[model samples]
Target: MKTIGRRMRFYRTIGAKLKGGEMAAILNISQGSYSDLEHDHAKPSSDTLIRYCTETDINIFWLLTGEGKMARPIGEVEKEKEENSEISIIWQNGMVVGNHQVDNDHKYLISLINTIQAAVNCGLGKEVILNYIAQLLSYTEVHFKREEEIQRSIKFNSLDEHKESHKRLLDQLISLRNEVGSAEPGEHQKAILEILFNDLTEWLFRHMLDEDLKMTEYFNLEKNHRVEDNSEE
Candidate 1:
């Protein structure tokens, strides 16, 4: 764990250098505290660690074990592997309403999914993995709030059903975290990673396809009505 801490500090330094003060601000920590991380004098909280990875392209595996490249090197091999990999959320025009704001939020969700994929591939230790999950939970809360607001504005008849789906997702994610927390640290990493790759992926993919698609269609229909009414006027 001490070694992992050192490696984390190393990567944080490199990441801070790349992103400058914006990353530090997002984590809500001082430059001095971040400096302490780089210097190996201060251990970061799980929330802070998660925010660092969320804000930067640092390799989670390298940050833990100090074995792999700090970033996945760009190459034909990497590109081919990424292409072949099954993404958690399958993007479809039919699943997106073409509302710029909603679409942008969806894109951010995809980014978070991809980050989780990267973290899993990195084989980081339990603590680091948990930290990443915490960060995901925080961001998901904000995203859900925005999504529900949009649904309300449109008066989508299925808003209650959609909100229930979001609640279910939150419950499942929290349950997974609790289960991981109960396990011995060394044994927990693999189990949590498996859940992310299998259960979480399936949930996100199904939720978007089955539930979000309805919202998309509803918004599109409303948009078309306004356009038609304007033409008639």
Candidate 2:
């Protein structure tokens, strides 16, 4: 119960910093219940677990196992002991769609994103930083391609718009990388990192809720259809 309480408190502390009311809304839980969860007065249900992971970028490993840091392990504490510098991305479960391939791809993309953040936080040199960015860009393209193919196969109506959004994100990332590449080290690098963190955090959250959620709904419908057909047969 204390483990649950610690996890909930961890969530609540970050949630308060990031806007408690908004996070509660995203989790679809009452603020009172959310507070209770943080205080160890209540436990999260299955659905709450799914939503928290998806919405808050909380580490499921740390949440469940209590083996690692409560927040993302971006850098060693001795290196940049800044009180506020912690990686705050949560991994949400993709809720077993019939498409194993697509789900796996999504997980890989998430891992890449987290890895890049970790690399940045570790204070790597410019070349190493650039390499990480390139890796992120490359994998993101592949991930988007696979996701689009799945949408096309199912004739998802918003495929065009979704793909367009993906293109825009890719373009933005490329431009940002180029900007960072030319900047002198030190303050400029820090500024570039701030921009990267803000943009990436915003984009991931919105994309999951807006674009990826649509795909999740489509797969759910397809799954239900197949189940109904099998029942009929």
Candidate 3:
């Protein structure tokens, strides 16, 4: 992949299961710097990458090239499992936006991303990735519509702004999907898949935390305002 940090974070979180602080300590960097690295805000040094792989038994080649399996197996059993395993995001409690329907949609979207990632991990080729991306694009359109409806029902002041954000994300996805459709097989397709998955993961995760979580804030404010009105009455 072009961004080493994304692969670093994937190995750190999925393979090693290390938290940011824990991973930073291993890499001998500040937690803030490590966070920046994972988010692709900062570039990691070669020393840092080497140290991380050395400590975790991660395959440096795979981490750097996005080829082969992730972990360099220390045992036969581990080797078998690692061989079959794919890089995927684990859903966390903190990702929940406190809106049931929206949260469900978010979970499903994450699952879809994970499925596409697995297909890529197994070297399933272009057609499979294209089909999965098509399905994801269809569901995402539905999810955005549902989210906007909820916002409207609640009289959310920023509904229009939220709709605009959805439009932008969808447009970006469509662009990437089209690129995948036209890409040649083998290395070219592999490169596009890497970019597509990394970009999609980053955008969707940020949307949930930075944008979708605003819905929870709106709900809390509304509840407190109603409480104040009752007290005044």
Candidate 4:
């Protein structure tokens, strides 16, 4: 369908076989908001679009433009990852938030996620994979603190909302970590990896692209004003 609403409803009812509430939970939105999305009453944010794509393994380009296949084939996903072994989640220019330290932290976080993917693909032991998850979670806490500090320095208006988002991400990571730790190695390996790739990685991706990118506009304006002041001196 061309309209995102129609497509959303189609995916919810047919593609993913999920009810509205279930899909809403997956996107971290309320039932009312999800209904509005399906009825074309409201446009989705970048965060919503990213969550729908990543969580459902739906083709993002198709989700927005309806140009590509609805979902990438499993073989294609595996092949693509094999070809790009260094990174599982591709970083794009849009993900940059115009802050050097924060951007570097994002890059490191992506690398940590990729490291976990590699471990899973290599059939590493559960303990080894758990260690990587711990590293990602630890570094994520550091990254969130750094991000909040930078925003505070600038008095970013959306700081509170952003911090709440960080808390949600951390909670999801903790839950995933516990779930993976509890699963049987051979039986639940696939399920564990799927959650890592879809839920955890994409949630972080959505945060950087949608939440942190908000900083770019404010940061640039702040920089420009500072430059003008320097010129006046």
lDDT of 4 by residue, 89-157 (tens): 655554567889999998899788878888887878889989999999999999999999999999999
TM-score of 1: 0.57
- Runs of candidate 3 exceeding 4 Å displacement: 1-85, 221-233
C-alpha root-mean-square deviation, each candidate: 19.0, 9.7, 9.5, 8.3
* Model 1, position 94: C-alpha lDDT score: 34
Rank by TM-score (best first): 4, 3, 2, 1
Worst 10 residues of 4 by lDDT: 1-10
**Candidate 1 lDDT by residue in tens digits, 1-233:** 12222223343333423343544664555776566444542444333454455333444345445666554333543464457544444454433555777777766766676677677677766676677668767877887788899889888888898889889988887876676667675556576665665555544544554456567677778889999999999
Off by over 4 Å in 4: 1-41, 45-87
Q: Which residue segments of model 2 deviate by more than 4 Å?
A: 1-84, 94-99
Q: Kindly provide the TM-score of model 2 when superposed on the true structure, using C-alpha atoms.
A: 0.60
TM-score of every model versus the real structure: 0.57, 0.60, 0.61, 0.68
Task: Return the clash pairs for model 4, or none.
Answer: none
- What number of backbone clashes does candidate 2 have, counting pairs of residues 3 or more apart or in separate chains? 3
Model 2, residue 224: distance off in Å is 0.9
Per-candidate clashes come to 0, 3, 0, 0
Best by TM-score: 4
